[model samples]
Target: MKRFFSLPNEIFSLGLSPGALALYSYLLYCEDRKTYQCYPSYASIGKSVCMSVNTVRKYVAELEGRGLIITEPTSVITRDGRKHNGTLRYTILPIRNAVDRYNQRRLRQLEETVERMRIRKKLEGNEEHPA
Candidate 1:
């Protein structure tokens, strides 16, 4: 079955690098509804995003740092009792929190701007009215 993931516009507002955005998109594409996560190898992710494995790792780290995703190192054991490292499990975070943060920052900036304007208007009025 073909799977699709919904990406919100807040991604653009997040200011992620191009590579990070591509990696994020691929991760979203790979998300399994049942698990709410994806575990693609770095090489596979690189191939999908047209980036090198190292580049994929770099961007994935960036995403993790930005709180857009969470990753956990995992391992698996084979039938022969051999232990091997498995793909990194990634949990994509809902963008609502990020969106709220962005909105709060924007609102603060706007408030500051309005305050500055009000102060300037008061100063100008004082200068003109000799008060």
Candidate 2:
């Protein structure tokens, strides 16, 4: 049996690096169909994505920063009653939400640029008029 997942076209427009994109795709592939969540060790993800554990960690942070995924720390109790950290629980957020956020941020940046240009033009006009 072959497993597959779909990647949204808008993800490419979000300006994520290749490593981040690969990690996000791997998470999507691992998530449950009903829950959109998965628990995978950093080593597991790294092995699957051909990245080092530290690189996987970096990309995971990148995805979380971009609102592409939410990661929760997990703990497990050993048979001896000792507690230890376990694999992280990753919840894949909706691509639409990410796309909306990206669009809004870009719009704000463009607005700020336009305002700066307007101010510069006004300053130039004042300079030319000797006012």
Q: Taking the candidates one at a time, how many backbone clashes does each contain?
A: 0, 0
- For model 1, the stretches where C-alpha displacement exceeds 4 angstroms are 101-131
Please provide the root mean square deviation of candidate 2 (C-alpha atoms, Å): 1.1
* Predicted structure with the largest lDDT when compared to the true one: 2
Model 2: residues >4 Å from true position, as ranges?
A: none
Error of 1 at 81 (Å): 0.6
Model 2 pairs whose backbones collide: none
lDDT of 2 by residue, 44-83 (tens): 9999999999999999999998899999999999999999
Q: lDDT tens string, model 1, 1-131?
A: 97567887889997789999999999999988777699999999988889999999899899887778899999999999999999999998878776676678779999999999999999999999993
Model 1 scores a TM of: 0.74
lDDT of 2: 0.94
